[model samples]
Target: MWNVPSLEEKEPELVREVEWFRLYTWTHFSPSDTCRTYGSGVVQPFNGSAFYVRSNCAFILTHFTHNRVEYDITIRRGDNGLLSEVEIIINKVRTVLQNGSILVEKKSVSLPYDHTYQHVFRYGIYTRFKSSLLPLTVTWHDVPGGIDTLWVELEKEQNSDITGLCGKFNAEAEPKCPGDLVYQDKGPAYVPSCSNPNPRFIDQENTSSCVCPDGKVLNDRADGFHCVTVSSCSCVFNGRTYLTGETRSTRCQSCLCKDGRWHCSENSCPPRCLIEGEFVTTFDGKQFAVPENVLVFWQSSMYVQVQTSFGMKIQVQVFPEIQLYITPPRNHSGVISGLCGNNNDDTTDDFTTSSGIIESSAKLFALSWSLGACSENIPNPCINTDNALKCPKNQEFSYNLLACNHTCRSLSGPDPRCNLQDAPVEGCGCPEGTHLNQENNCTPRSECECHHHGGATPPGPVVIDGQQW
Candidate 1:
């Protein structure tokens, strides 16, 4: 009997585990970047993370939505490799910034975790938000025994990736086209009745051993799939296997074959993009290419679904009118849209699909706005600051000039929606008799002068010094 050494008797050698650790998440697109159009959305629905894996550096981005505003977080790996920052500016006035402690590799901590937006009934979360892309930078201890610190200056977007703003991620794709691709087969699979798996497939090889064997054939059980037409009208299949019953339908039965178009059958063919114009919307700023059969709806604001080759429905809306301010204000929450798109074929609504650039290096932009909100208080038209009853300026309508007295500079801005800034126009000057007080506009003296108006006295030429004497 051959004696085999027991498992424990084997030479003891230590195997090292591959170096792996976790890093804290960092969140903030850039320190500071200018933005025009203002729009905001929740970054994370639940708890999850995104990582930027570089040569020797890896950082994790964690996010969660509270109330409606989103909170961002960052984490890095290595000894004392942890760095985190989150900043928020509301109404361009009150600001809140939080920084975390320096951490080591494989270390973790859940801070008193509260930007503390009063998400309660008395102080519910603010529904409005804004964001813009700015240059980004990161610092870490990736030096000696550490990794190389990484700094990235995100390129300014010539045109932001607006497509992602309008795009819905394609989680997975499913079947969308006909399964049976028109593939011609040979041998028994091609034979008329014999259903031969292998035969005299070559057209003129008159060999008796290969011809479609008459009577019982060794090819009776031929297997495979194919598409064939006899008399171009009645079609049949002996080896084709479908989840449902066999198909003998004519070529014209599926979809209209207008203008000699071929009948393509693949269950998962993707549709093309329908973006034709410089279509910009509140959605992502990524560029999108127009595709065939894709209906880009300028008339309607809705999602233009991209049926991928895997049957996964990825939605890319077309809002050619986003800049036009037709429906809900650009910064407001609203749906912008595009029509269905098909391939390059002349077919319009045939509903067939073609492949698209599902992945690309496209830039993304976020629109934003700032301050200036107006008060809704309508001042009494009849009363003056002196508590005196004043005669209406526009008598026919009893309209008070003071009622329209709006100060443009008084508008709280830097954020458009804040105090609701004054409208884009020059304001009114002094009233008639008052002739502009110290402010140089209108100031009512003892008797209100109607000079500017018809009743007001006109200014007579005055003698300078003693010239009149």
Candidate 2:
């Protein structure tokens, strides 16, 4: 008895797997003739010199010629109806017949978002078979787990290999048009008839072979190589039309494309608390980018730090409940924004500044404060001297500025409240002949009865020194 290997035991010298997906097609120049198909479709098998193979289950709607193809994939979110980043995979194959045997090689490429990819057989050696009839197969893989759609016939050019082959084989009286020559004895299996009621059955040739680098459609157009984006109409991107709230991004912000417009919001990242130039001699030997006149306080027990510029009048306190409290200036109208809380997971809060820098007060802080913070009045034990209580940024903290019967600094003279040395003496006072009122602005002083001995004085200029006016 003669021993023979089973069909399953001997693998074919050339084998290819092309995953089929739903595809849409069109037959006419108008948009009304659009057609669609969903499920596996087969391409006609090519009977070459030594081997014959058919692309099974994969949709073969058009002839794929050796040319650059372009298409776009539309990706959408599954949970919500929003568009998402798309990923595409292309499987490339190379086949050659040498030494009376067929050899096969495979490779792949991955792409993100909507992009066009080319499928050209210009491997120099492969071009040598310009006039010879050979068999080749191309496959593409779609990224899984996303809303994937392939828009075919958007802006594309479709060519048939018979036209190229005729030009090569018939060197004299070369065919100028596909109708000039005739081909026969082809199966309907490879004929793409989704859009056409009757398609001409011919040997499998390249027609519209290039699907979206990420989608599942093959189409041909006469208006040059173009593709319809999956998420766009006239406002299309890549190839598809996008609905409202489809998001795209740049370095600083995320932009949502909607109804022919783009709405963008800031995409902020946490700022690094770096102290440049000098390694921190204190606080874990870290580096920081400290601005001039800025003070940084690190509390070891609380494991928190505060960085404020000198004279800012802002106070930052961290309590046991992992809360950060920021007190802005007395007349605050500025914006204060920075990172806070633990290093691993810091929190952020923003407040309108009194000055252009950073500004607010305790009760007023509740007006527009963010980050879900509360107050516990935790005083800093490290600050013992009065100098540390000086105002921050653009503010003044007069100890008794609102107290009655206190000596007030005259507006006519330079403001002494700004001087940290005079903080102890700073008090609220009105100009001469005025008294402190509910409003901080000075008001006219009330007349009072005088009990001095009766004496009438007239307005006159008198000088005891010899120079009298």
Q: Note the Cα lDDT for every prediction shown.
A: 0.25, 0.29
Per-residue lDDT over 35-80 for candidate 2, one digit per residue giving the tens place of the 0 to 100 score: 1111222112121111111222112222334444322121223322
In candidate 2, clashing pairs total 46
Name model 2 segments beyond 4 Å from true: 1-207, 211-298, 301-303, 306-469
Q: RMSDs, each prediction?
A: 35.4, 28.7
Judging by lDDT against the true structure, name the best candidate: 2
Alpha-carbon runs more than 4 Å astray in model 1 = 1-203, 213-301, 304-317, 321-469
lDDT of 1: 0.25
TM-score of each: 0.13, 0.16
**Cα error of candidate 2 at position 91, Å:** 46
